[model samples]
Target: MTFVTSEPYIGHMGLGGIGDSKGLLESELRKRHIKWVDNARVTSVDQDKVNVEQLDEKGRVANTHELPFAYSMLIPPFAGVDAVQGIEGLVNPGGFILIDKHQRNPKWPNILAAGVCVAIPPSRPPRCLPAHRRPD
Candidate 1:
């Protein structure tokens, strides 16, 4: 489980606690003779076994190993949008949804974007010399 804290003061404590909890859980599992693999990245999986690449503490690929598990949870990295060919008047040239100054679509004034992936205009003009020189 991942615990995320945005508060400046609690951020450090929350991350430290997560690390400590994971270590304690692993230690307890080891005591019960349960085998555990750390830094094993899944490359692929077949019907019986999964191909994994082991990484060193520095995150460099050191060796490859295959392991069998009754069940596994696989999480994939987030991929960006592909070519927006069929869509018309919805996406910008960069494949991102475009919005106006009030975060409303220019073509569809009723549509408003308010989420993590929503695109917003830069608060200031781009390429302005010395970041502080830009108007707020």
Candidate 2:
């Protein structure tokens, strides 16, 4: 089996990784003989093949790979529904529902949410540098 991900490294899982997940997942994949490609961008997907561009440290295309598959699943970034947009305290700027300790909406006591629909703050700051340079 082959695994492709946009994450900078295996096991990042888009949340800066959980403790030891990087090592553990890498070990498991290796033991199972699963081939993986990280830092990848899916340029296109056809019926039988997926075209991917692997990026480098400077965000340049390092290599392009065409992976053929009989079946595939793509998990994109999560987002809230349009119906929940602009609901003030009930939702975050991205529209994901805001939940408290009980997974209940702060604005509406009767409402609750779960799954990807719930807003989760980043566990760590982003790794990217700022977009603009500071003045001397």
Candidate 3:
């Protein structure tokens, strides 16, 4: 089984920062022998193979390769669900749910959200999204 994701880090939950949890996750993946590819973009998928496009340091496509799979599960990028997506005030421009200090929708206080779709700024760089908690 192969899990492909664009981001490098694993265990993106709030309790452990991206740096801390990845060691454990990587160790376990090594123990179980799972192949983890970071910073990869899947260009296409077919019955027998998935085509991957890897970029060079200059932000150009450096290599394209095919990965074979007997059974593969693809978890694409998380977007706000269709239910609340694109509603004028409910979501941000990127379609992440807009929440207040309580993680409840600011405009509609009764609505609460959790998981990958909540709008939190990246902590490290220009673009990254890790789970953010209210600091309990």
Q: 1-136, model 1: which lDDT tens digit per residue?
A: 2211121212122122343565676567657766555545678889877777766544677687777767766655332246542345656554556677787867788877665334445433433135776666
Reference-based lDDT, residue 105, model 2: 94
lDDT of 3 by residue, 50-89 (tens): 9987665335676777899988788766666777778877
As a TM-score, model 3 comes out at: 0.66
lDDT of the structure predicted as candidate 3: 0.70
| Residue 97 lDDT in candidate 1 | 60
lDDT of 2 by residue, 1-136 (tens): 7899988888786676778888999999999999999988899999999999998866899999999999998888566878989999999988999998899998997999998888875565434434454222
lDDT of 2 at 46: 99
Q: Each candidate: what lDDT?
A: 0.53, 0.84, 0.70
RMSD of 2: 4.8
Name every residue pair that clashes in candidate 3: none
Arrange candidates, best TM-score first.
Answer: 2, 3, 1
Steric collisions counted per model: 0, 0, 0
Q: Name every residue pair that clashes in candidate 2.
A: none
